[model samples]
Target: MLQLDLKTTVFLASIMSALMSVVLLSAYHSFPRSIRGIGQWVAGSLVLVVAPMLFWLRDIAPAWISIVLANGLLLAAVALWTLGTQAFYGRPPARRPAAIVVVAATLAVTWFVYGRESYEARVTIVTFAMGIFFGAQALLVLRHGGRDFSARFFGFLLAVQTLVVLARGMASLFAGLGGQTLFAANDVIQTVYLGSYTLMDLGLSVAFMLVITRRLHVELDILSRTDPLTQLLNRRALYDAGQRELAHMAEHGGEMALLLIDLDHFKHINDSLGHAEGDRVLTAFSAMLKRELPAGAHPGRFGGEEFLVLLPRTTMAAALALAERLRATSSRFFGRQVADLTISIGVASVDKAEHRLDGAVRRADLALYRAKSAGRNRVEAVMEAAA
Candidate 1:
């Protein structure tokens, strides 16, 4: 049987960790600026790898430079990982707890070395510190990530690592102390500890890259389908969703309603208030649609200053009411937020299979033109055609 020793596992893991860090850091920098926190994750992995490598040098170097330094670096690495997780979920990085952990661990390590030669005490305190940091990193992911699968998985991984570390720390109380050094390549307990640490930290390094990549993919997907300024589904997404809903309603049997909404004098607002403020108007109107639109309504940006809302299982009168609500919400925000910002909406109702959604949208567009002609900030309903 081939037995794995502490130095062998630690050295191999260190080299692999450094390589992984380089690749991850390179990829993170090459990615678009929208995806945040990859840098911190890579840096943390690098520090973690270096910490173990430093431990391997304990026999040749001073205890302060080797054991204490390695433990301090390990704490720093956990802090970086926690900070990265915060950034991953769009939360501000917290520094106080990390500072506290580093300070406490440093003091403990200093006292163990200066006041006494109790290696067990020194190792026990370091284990608890590492466990605390690991637990904290896990909590950061859970708190900010909520039920997100990737985030939860990463947090769970940290929790597992924490359990292993904390168990070792407590187990030390009952285990017999001997003359074996932590870095002794042949020490059984040392080998077990180093092997477990290497495996767990390696898993963390790999997991971080996976989570970052998944986040970047998700962000790219959202960016592709949504309007950048309004954060609403774009015209392509609107058409796709409309087609899907039409198919769904065809099978399920429901009335499908389409509303074409045009911001009243949107061009005038852009020219008068500048495009920057005009963007604010569009964003505000999109927010109102999100809040006030009927339940299950899919609101999308149809074009410049124009939006499309699809409501399923709706009657003509109900569709009209929704359109009026939309008009009112936009009109109510006029003068106070944006200069005279209001919307003209055209409502069209039809059975799911009566005609394609594009045809219904065209009819709704015509009604919207009618609303603009009659007066701005009003809803005009296009009646279902005779069978």
Candidate 2:
């Protein structure tokens, strides 16, 4: 049992250290400019410092002093945990006065206990205060906004820690009153209480690490589907969306439209000015499209100098009108000195029986080809060609 307890303590300490390192490193990389990240780093670093302090002070002179210090360290950990939770949930800044109150109260109690003649009363009061503060914070998180698994896990950990503190407080109170006279009995109680609390703290730390890892994974997935420059769905995302839309339309009877827009004389702009200026134009045009399109429309960069817009509930006439509006907007905006910049738009709306988005896009391409051949800066509907 002694070997097992020692191994568990060491393993828990190592895990806590690893989690603290990850939180610090991630904050550095992702949130260097954020004040909240800085606060979390400070808190995490302090916890790392204090965990070892708690272990070292276990056998220090005047047992109440060690108890006071350990409680103080746990309070610090709670404060840091609050800050980290707020940062993750995008909650507003925590009140400074409340944080100051918690810290000052812990310190004042620590000082008072260190000077107290009766160690039992001092330890009991300090332990109760620790439990109240930590338990209250955990309950607040659980009641307000901790809906995710990480938040719930954290709450559970805090509740368990609070119980451990309460158990320790009871043990100390009983020992001080001479209710448990045997030294071996006291040792067994102390060992069990410390062992349980250590394991609880270690579990919470690991849970927080898992939450950060999961959040990072989700962010990476979003980045993969988004265009870095335009901040729009990239071609791959658009293709997936198109496939889904195709399947939905096959089941329901609704018209879907595809608009393929190509900038006129884009190569000339790159040649006359610079690629940098050309990039600006593309970005500006993308922003304009995003602003002009109605809600529920999906716009994406099809490639260099080309864009695609999907309108799920639009008819052929409505799609043509939107294309015309886009052409006019581009003409007015890019007319000053950009070679009378205009867009040739090919619009194709699904016919009543058509069930394929790819077929619709091919028809739109053909119409767009005809529009360019006839004259640039025009909206050509595929149905118009057959009419």
lDDT string, candidate 2, 223-337, tens digits? 7888888888888888888777777787876878889999988988899899988988888888989999999899998888888898888888888888999999899888864
The digit string of per-residue lDDT tens for model 1 on 204-316 reads 77777777777778888888899998898998888888788888877888788889999888899878879998888888878978988867888999989899988888888
Best of the candidates, TM-score? 1
Query: Stretches of candidate 2 above 4 Å error?
Result: 1-49, 59-69, 92-99, 114-196, 333-339, 351-356, 384-387
Clash counts for all predictions: 0, 0
- The runs of at least 3 residues in candidate 1 whose Cα sits more than 4 Å from the true structure, single-residue gaps closed, are 140-153, 184-188, 338-341, 385-387
lDDT at residue 381 of model 1 (Cα atoms) = 75
CA lDDT, every model vs. true structure: 0.79, 0.70
